[model samples]
Target: PSRSATLAALDVRKRRDFTVHDLDHRHHLWHEGDDARRWAREAAKRATVVLGNIEEVEMATGTRNPVAGAAALLDLGAKIAIVKRGGEGVYARTASEEVTVRPVEIPVLNGLGAGDAFGGALCHGLLAGWPLRRTLEAANAAGAIVASRLACADAMPTLAEIETVLARKVSA
Candidate 1:
């Protein structure tokens, strides 16, 4: 779906269900896609958060430099911009802070939707009003858990399970 149209929909639906107000974009840039920037800007006006696939950003923008892109989003007023870096971790930024959360080391089985899982967990944490550090930690643990197991959505750990990993210092 087009970003601008998506943003318009979110604006209407936000009051009813904030959980469904996720901002997703295909990881590509249109160079001509000024609409995306405008959408991001508009969502920022409503204090919306942005989550995205890193590969799409790299392929479309011709760069994987999430920091730069995040800066653009921040400038446009996004409350937070999360860029999933797969095995490395997640890069997140807000108007006041920037954070690079490293993934916990774990044996990998299959890598699919790990980034989305991490982003989803982070969104959950935000919804719960967790602090940024705790949110990143929870998100990282969730991604690591998903990476270590073979199943798709089934690999994602429960909050209790993630907390267990967070408490340990396991070497991957």
Candidate 2:
């Protein structure tokens, strides 16, 4: 954007550690000096993982198609790309694999903390060496629990809670 970068600390570097990028479109900034459409794609070059909502992914990759957007991110060097589809679940893609995890049905109470919970659970799953689909499934469950609750920190789900949802789904 034409407006100066607000967060100068944001830099995607070539690092040995795995990096996850949750796209946060800075729509408030002017785009005269920058191209907002390619921000996520550009950042993907240095990211190991990229995750965003459909709108955000479309804005970043210039495509509303989730599969194409994931491919676009992968083309830009991201190892994994995940498009959050809210209640429809998430579309996760890697060079060799792709998955669309089913959503956990729940009564919507407060959705404010869902994304945060999802991100935290994503990191937890990745760090724990879970496969992409398993990671997304647990992340989705964590988000579902948060959305079904009213509190903030207290609403954040535990690993047991997330696994319980997964276990139930499996048993069903």
Candidate 3:
């Protein structure tokens, strides 16, 4: 299903059942003013998980600190919140704890679609029942691999590739 369709359904139902929202800031460029802020906050409050970069988090939650911003979202009702910090890696928060995953460097050919790759791996980890740290590791690795490549969709790594990246990190 399209993201807009899913978002519309969520808006109507406020269903909390394993919904993941990737708050791509570019998509919300049209949002401004108090009403827009209210809408963004409400949309975040309904999700089981919300993922975005620091800028997106600040734009939605009006805070510069991702962890603090995520905590605010949790107060509004999201179960999990993640802030993607490019080279700094990711910061994830839950009601009980917060964790930051440091980035793993790799050759960078292009940055396009790295975030998409990260989101995909994040969902994969959640669905597979991996711990938050493991999920972030996998997502980070997936994103690094994508960034090292020149293409986006065509360069998506296979499961084996992801596993290899994880293994390398472990050994290092």
Top-lDDT structure, candidate number = 3
* Candidate 2 lDDT by residue in tens digits, 1-172: 3222422223524533567778866567635766766555666665788889889898888888999998988887788899999878899899899999988888889998898899999999999998888899999999999999999788898899999988988888
TM-score of 3: 0.88
Q: What C-alpha RMSD separates each model from the true structure?
A: 4.3, 2.9, 2.6
Global local distance difference test of model 3: 0.82
Q: Evaluate residue 37 in candidate 3 and report its C-alpha lDDT on the 0 to 100 scale.
A: 52
Q: What is the C-alpha lDDT of each candidate?
A: 0.67, 0.82, 0.82
**Which window of ten consecutive residues has the lowest lDDT sum in model 3?**
27-36
Better of 2 and 3 by TM-score: 3
Model 2 TM-score is 0.86
Please provide TM-scores, in order, for all candidate models, with all chains considered together.
0.72, 0.86, 0.88
Candidate 3 lDDT over 1-172, as tens digits, reads 3445756867776655568877776654563453545666767777888888888888788898977888877877888889998888899998887888888778899999899899899989999999999988899999999999999998888778989988887788
lDDT of 1 by residue, 1-172 (tens): 4665766776776634232333455435545645554554465445446655575444333356898766655554466766767667778787788888776877988777566567778878888989877897788888778888888787777899888888873433
Off by over 4 Å in 2: 1-13, 26-34
Better of 2 and 3 by lDDT: 3
